[model samples]
Target: MPNTSRRTSKRDLTLVAVLVVAAIGLITYLVVSPPGGDDGAAQQPAGPSGPSASQSEGSAGADESPLSGLARRDEGDPTALGPVDAPVTMVMYSDYRCPFCAKFSRDIEPELIDRYVDSGQLRIEWRDFPIFGEQSEMAARAGRAAAEQGRFWEYNRAIYEDSPERGHPDLTREVLLDYAHEVGMPDMETFTADLDDPSLDEPVREDLRQGSSIGVSSTPTFVINGEPILGAQPLDTFVEVIEGAAGQQ
Candidate 1:
C-alpha cells in the first residue's frame, strides 16, 4: 500500500509506542502454560460464526459464577501499571462520548478489573481518543484534567457510568467539574489551563490516528497484549484472548 497519510505527531508516536510495548509483554507471557482452567478467561469457540451449542452449555456454569469471565493468575510481573502483575494486558483507545466506550467501562471492565487488575495480574491502560468534534475534545481535555489531579481513571469511570443522551450535553466543563468533585479531584483551574498544552493534547490525537492506521476505526478498540480487539465485545471474547496469549508462553 502507498503511504498516503500525513505527518505523525509526537503524541501519536507515543501512543504507538505504548501499544507496541504492551503487545510485546503479552506475547512474551504466552510462551508459558497456565496452571488450570480459569472460568474468567473464555476459551475460543469451535466454529467460525460463534460458539457451538455444546460450548455455550459448557460455559453456562462458569458464567453463573462471580469470577466467570475474570482472568485468573498473577505472578508479580514488573513493568505493570494499572492492575499490577496481570498476566494479560488490555489497552483501550476510547472516546468518552462513545456509547460503546460507556458500555465497556460500566459493564465489561469491572469483571476484568476485579479479576485481573485488583489481583495484580492485569493492567488496563486507557487512551482517550476524541473523534466526535468539540464534545469529544471537551471529554479528552477533561480526562487530562482528571489525570492532572490524580483522578484520571475515576473520572474516566464516571463519564461512562453517567452517559448522556445523544444530542444532549456531554463532555461539558461543568459536568466534568461535577465528576471531578465526585471523584475528589480538586484544582480545576490548573487542569483547565493544562489542557491547552500541546503535550497534553497529542496523546489523544495520536491514539486516534494510530488506531486508524492499525485498522481501529471505532471507539472502544482494544489492544490485548498487542492484539487489536474491536468494540465492546463480550467478556468471554476477552478471556479467550488472554488465555490464548498465556498458552503461547
Candidate 2:
C-alpha cells in the first residue's frame, strides 16, 4: 500500500511539472511572436535595453522578475486606477493612436474597471508607449497634461471613444484640445500651456524606454502580475489571466 501511494505521488508531481513547462513555453511563444499580425496593434522593432523602469523607480525587489516590477503602485499617480495595494496589478503599455488600443479602451477596459478595480481586486497602471509617430508623442504629452488637472482617465475615454473604428484617427493638436474641452477640462489655459511642457516629455520618454527594455514591441501590451498579454485579446482571456493571478495571491 505504501509503494502504491509513493507511485501516485510521483505521478502527480510529474504531471504538475509538465503543465508548468507547457505554460512557460506558451508564454515565450506569445512574447516572441504576437498574435493577430499587423492589424492588431502598432508594432516597433525591439531596441536595446535602457535603464529599466523598475530600477529607476526602485519599485522592484532583487528577486522579482522585470515584468512584475513594471507595476508602479504610486498612490499619487493620477493616471492610475484602483488601490495601490491591490492583489493583482496590471501595467498597461499603450499608444493613443493605435486602433487596437482604442478598441480595448472602448470595450474591455470599462468592464475591467467595473469588475476588478471597483471591487479592489486589481490595480491598473498606465504607461505611454507611443510608437506611431510625432502625433502619438503629442497625444501622450496631452494625457500627462490632463493628469495635472485630475482628469486623465476622462481625457483617455474621450480620446478613445471618439476615435474612428477602422483606422488610427489623426490626433492633431487641435483635436487633442477638442477632446480636453469635451471632457470639461476646467482651465483650458492651463491645459493648453501644459501640453508642450518639456517636463511632460520625460515621463513619456521614460515609459517608452521602459517598454522597450521589457521587449514590448507593440501597443496594447499588458503585464498582469508578471505575465504578459500582448495585443487586445478577448475579454475571457483577460478574465482568466486576472483570476489566475488573483488565485495565486
Candidate 3:
C-alpha cells in the first residue's frame, strides 16, 4: 500500500497556506466593497449559500474551500458562548489529546475570553477535530456530552488539567466519566447516557470533517474572522488579528 498518511500530511500544510492568502484577499475585498449594498455591491458575485455573500465573495476563486464554508456562526450552539452576531467569529479546531491544544486551553484562551468574548466583540465556536485515534475521539464525545449539561467548558478545563502535556492519554470511558464527575456534572446518569449515545457521534464526526475541509492537520488551529492562525500562536498574534478583524466592523 502507498503512504497515504504522509501524503495527506503534505497536503494539509499546503492547504493551510491557502487560508492566509485567502484572508488577505478577503480583507482587501472587505475594504473595497461598499458596505450597505450600494451600487458597487451589485457587481460582486453572489456567493455560495452557506456563508453570507458579503464575507464569502472575497474568497471567490476558492469557492469550495473550507474557510468560506466553515464560518457558520452557529448562533444557537449550546457549547458556544457570546452573541452570534458578534463582530468577529473565531472558529477553533482542537484535539483533546494534543498538548499544544491543552496549552491553548490553559494559557491563551482565557485571556481571549476576558478581552474579547466578555466585551461582546468576539464569538468563539469550538469544533472537535480529534486526530489522535480512538482516545481523542472519546474525549471529544465526552465534551459534547458535557455540553448537554452546560458544563462543556468546565469539563474541558478539568480534562486538560488532568492530561499530560505531551502524548495521548488513555481516554477510556472510565476516565471520561471521572472527568465529568470532576467537572461537577449534576447527573452522572444523564452525562454517561449522553456520552454513550451513538447519536452524539455524528456531530463530533462533522466537526472533524469541517476541520479537514479547511486543511487543519494540527491541533488548536483557529480561524478568526476567516483568517487562520495555526498552532498555539503567541498572544500578540491573536491580539493583532482580532483587533484588525474588529476594526473592520
Candidate 4:
C-alpha cells in the first residue's frame, strides 16, 4: 500500500490553509458591513471592504497600516479635538441625524475627552458624513458654519444632547439657525450667510466621499489608529482600543 500517513499529513496541511483564508474573509466581512447591516443610508457606491493584515494586530506599527493615513491631524481644524501629534488618532465618520452618533456624543465623548484628550494621548477628528437625507446635509453645512465661528463643538453638543433618544431628528434650516443662536455663535449674520453658502457644501461632500471610499455605509464609524471600530460600541471597547493603539505608539 502507499504511504498512508504521508497522504493524511498533506491533506491536513491543505485543510489548514483553506481554513486560514476563510477566517480572513470572515473578518473582512465583519469590518466592512458591520453588525447593524445597511439601512439604505449610503448615497454613494462603496469601495472594497477589508482592512489590511496590519489592522487586525493591536501592536502593528502605524507606518505599516493603510488606514492610518486617514487621520488628518490638522491642528487648526475647528471640528477636531485634542493635540495634533497625539499618540493615537481616531477619525470619526458621523452623521448629524444618526441617533447612535448622538448617543456616543452625549455619553462617551466627554469621558474620552477627560481621560485621553486631556492627557494628550488621543486626537479625535470629525468627518461630516451626512448620509441620512437633505436635512442631514443642511445640518452638516450648519456644523461647518459653526466651525467658522469657533462654536463647532458647542453646536455639536446642542444638536446631539437635544436629539431624540431614537430616530433621526428634524434638522430644518430654522432649527439649525436656532441651534446656532443657542450655541452663542459670535456672528449670527455670518453664520446664517454661511449656511446658504454653496462653498460650505464641498467639505461635507468631500468627507462623505472619503468615508464612502473606505466602505463606511453607516454613521458613527471610527478608524482608531489603523483599526476600524463600527457602530457606537461600548465605552470600554473604546478604552481598550485606544489603550491598545497608545501602547503600540
lDDT of each: 0.59, 0.78, 0.73, 0.78
Q: How close is candidate 2 to the true structure, as a TM-score?
A: 0.76
Instruction: Judge candidate 3 against the unseen true structure and give its global Cα lDDT, from 0 to 1.
Output: 0.73
lDDT of 2 by residue, 119-194 (tens): 9999998999887789999999999999999999999988998777655679999999999999999899999999
Badly placed stretches (over 4 Å) of model 2 are 1-65
- The segments of candidate 1 whose C-alpha lies over 4 angstroms from its true place after superposition are 1-86, 164-169
Instruction: Tell me how far the alpha carbon of residue 121 in candidate 1 is from the true structure, in angstroms, after superposition.
Output: 2.5
lDDT of 4 by residue, 147-198 (tens): 9989999999999999976667999999999999898999999999998999
Model 1 error, position 205 (Å): 2.1
Worst 10 residues of 4 by lDDT: 42-51
| Candidate 3 ranges beyond 4 A from true positions | 1-69
Better of 1 and 4 by lDDT: 4
Q: Write the per-residue lDDT of candidate 3 for residues 18-97, one digit (tens) a residue.
A: 44654555445445543333423222222331356655465444322234335655556776768878888888888888
lDDT of 2: 0.78
Query: What TM-score does each of the candidates earn?
Result: 0.62, 0.76, 0.75, 0.77
